[model samples]
Target: MVVIHDGYFTDVEGCIKENWFQIDSLLAKQILCRFSLPFNKLAIFTLYNNCVHLSAICILINLFHIYILTRKALRTTSPIYILLTAIAMIDIVSLSYDIHTEIVEVYKVFKVCYSKETDYTIILLNNIMEFIRNYSRRCSTWLSFSIALIRTLIVKYPLNPKLEILSKPKIAFYIIPTILILSAPIHFMDIYKYQIVFYDENFKCTQFPSYTTLYYGSILSDYYEQDDVWLWKLNRTIDAVISKFIPCILFPIVTYLLVIEIRLADERRKKLNQSSIAEKDSKNTTKLVLFLTLPFFLGELPIGLILLTKPIDKLREAIGFSLFTEGIEKFFSVVLSATTATHMIVCVFMSSQYRESALSFIRCGVKFKSQNS
Candidate 1:
């Protein structure tokens, strides 16, 4: 999603105006025509399937939560369960947005002829895409960390009533708004490529931002130039510290804390081990954490390694190696998707409690339909 600026920013800076919208259907058709370009359809197909799988998994998670809410016996004051439900809901909404982009609109509009004015609809769509992309990145990072934190709390302080503060519903409600506020700065980031521009009857959006090529094409040059070097370094350093360093540090620490808590409980409670229910619960809980956390760690490693090697630019222009990079990205996305899907499968397959509850809900719906018939 990075851009390389070849000073097109200067040529178009004077053309940008606030409160303007443009949609060129002719341009959209032209863009989609490139689908005929010699590219790997297999890779594209894999990406499409990955997107569908992710969307379906998320939708199922949402359905599971609705089922949970239907079960009075299973309903409790347990904060952990509430947190899981909220996380599922968030994942569902985010995944739906992603699927909409891929299947519903690849940002293409076809018009038999060009309209003189910019399309307001496309402008609105562009803004919405920018907002969702920026905010979702921030939200997903924080939510995953929050989940890790909740698990650590449950394992570490099982009997501590004060641990109620980490309750799922409370944290879920609070964190959603907190993520929104934290991402407020994103509205001002303006660090996007392919922005709408107009100049002297030539109306089009350029991949590089007008008047600021430094933030566009070629990751290295985007943040590094002999001119304006300090601003670039400052921005790069901030991005590195927050995006790269914080998540890297936090995920591991929280994961380690969860592991230690589980071990401590296991060692301190030999009497409890005799109870089959306790042991089964403990094993399932451990599996849940391990299955979810492992992919995230694996996915994190490659990006971190690439950063350390200063390979962003090379990877971007890696024509010969581009396929390799794309493979790794697709693989990681699949790993994450598989892990998420496993969580849903666990709800139905491993947990008899959840399975029974889910089935009863389905049966009730069947009965209602039969009665109406």
Candidate 2:
């Protein structure tokens, strides 16, 4: 979601065309130097053009699949199914947040007439949006990681009765809530780091004396001055280290270990005269984990690195590098959104039961439509 903020100022037509959208002279100078044009606008336009409709359709499809998956998981009391259902639910929430924020942002960019009160409300909403976006995104990540961990346990400890208890829907319900509650505190840092500022009769919402502003002047300068600036920076560094960097490193390691365990189990099964139903289920779960994890790793790792680096003006000074970084950010936003949106499709392909349920649901719909006609 922070990635999407790069394009938030693209609608400043004055800044783009005539450099007339004055905030504070210092702020304007920092903005003009750091925030480039056409690329941001193009990224925003391209997102609306391509991702908006696709995301809407995917959300619908995801809801349908989530319904089927939830029913199946509850009926079967399958941990893997429950985890998949949880992932689907989180994806839906994340996608909804993205859609809502994008719509609000587009309105701010093109339609809303800025008033002091209106700007205040928008800024508040933006902060709330960032909170939800980060919260849901982290929840989604942890849920996926949980899936991989559960599957690894299943593969490695097939005979453990205690581990089998994890498959129960009641246990899954507990796990989901526990994950959500634990991850909530990490994102409180985001709320502290961002706030609304009013300048030159216009309200702007941004990080306190953002990297660009700090680059242009000392921390004590008129526009860049904020008593809590160091605290905010400290919080951001801690957040990046704990939330982004740790997970980025740990997820891949866990995934790799899961893959190895799954493979070893497969080989053991081959030596047997017959594989148990649980063994078969483990294989399917492994496949699903691979599908989900690949997209998450590819999409999130670079975004994490970008956030961790927090490119300063010196780094951004390279010719075309700023635009390039913006493009990378936008590109991964699409990837992450697409990955979340198409999750049901991944499940449908990876699990025969899901595919069959989907087909049956479609048939029922068709029959109902024909009867109505």
Candidate 3:
């Protein structure tokens, strides 16, 4: 019995020495760990693999849709056509990055092997992906806002020649480039905000310290106490407000005004007993804008809110609770990806122009195949 007690005591001492008693730390440490074989591994692999495949498929379909739309735009010289094409192009690029990131992650899990050189590549890709993801997201939201704002102007000032000029394809050429240029630099700041660190024999990219120094004559202070930390947090808050929340708020307001304008136009047309071609075209464009923006608002709002409210300390604290939180965060990421793919699918189904373009492309392919046969 004495020997048994001695052995048990030694085991407990060893566990304490190894820090296994720190359950919170253990859970936190496991947050980003690759899932082990059979169940967990299979589940994550399936989830990522499916997302990659679906996103790729949607991207290809959208590319075809863009080609058709561009050809139509050349003929019509319509600003709405130009904007739709630009949106499709952005979606394709964003989806490509999504697929690439998923592929790299899945490879990391299955192989469990990476070198220092590979670490640099991983870090670079991660930074690029982060920049593109944020840039594309903001661009999409802004483009939607532009559409709503322009439509509102058209409805409210139907006789304003200046507003009419702004709706031309020539103006879209300038507006699209301006939006791209504006949305890019803010997101590019992410390149400096993160760094790659070695963990579990693999390099992982994570946020760098917001401030390298605290102050003179002080024991190294906690990160949260740093002025730079709050500044960075505030920057993120402002970004979320501008890129996500404002657009969300404005979308509904502008859309409401659009509905009223449409009703007013319909009433005016009834009294005149003649609907001008421009009025019909404006109504159709409004329908397209509604279809495009509504899904984006619904699908992206949860993600934006999550980003705004996520606890900054969760990643730093090696705690068991963090595992649950991290898991929830990852689940949200999957939902976001699913929603992104759904947006393309929704476009194909809801937008008559996109659907017709896709169908026409398919028919052309069938005809070419028959001719070859």
Q: Estimate each model's TM-score.
A: 0.62, 0.73, 0.70
lDDT of candidates 1 onward, in order: 0.50, 0.63, 0.60
Candidate 3, 201-297: lDDT as tens digits: 3334334422211111112123433674674565566677778777878888999998898898889889989866556656766776677667666
Candidate 2's displacement at residue 201, Å, is 3.6
Candidate 2 TM-score, true structure as reference: 0.73
Q: Could you tell me how far off, in angstroms, the CA of residue 278 lies in candidate 2 after the best superposition?
A: 4.7
List the candidate 2 regions with Cα displacement exceeding 4 Å.
1-45, 48-50, 73-75, 105-115, 202-229, 276-278, 311-313, 316-324, 365-373
User: Candidate 2 — which pairs collide?
Assistant: none
Candidate rank order under TM-score: 2, 3, 1
Candidate 1 has which clashing residue pairs, if any?
3-216, 3-217, 4-217, 22-118, 22-119, 23-119, 79-168, 83-168
TM-score of 3: 0.70
For residue 85, model 2's alpha carbon misses the true position, in angstroms, by 2.6
Query: Against the true structure, whose lDDT is highest?
Result: 2
* Candidate 1 lDDT over residue span 207-275, tens digit each: 532432121122223334445444444543454455445777888888888888777777777756554
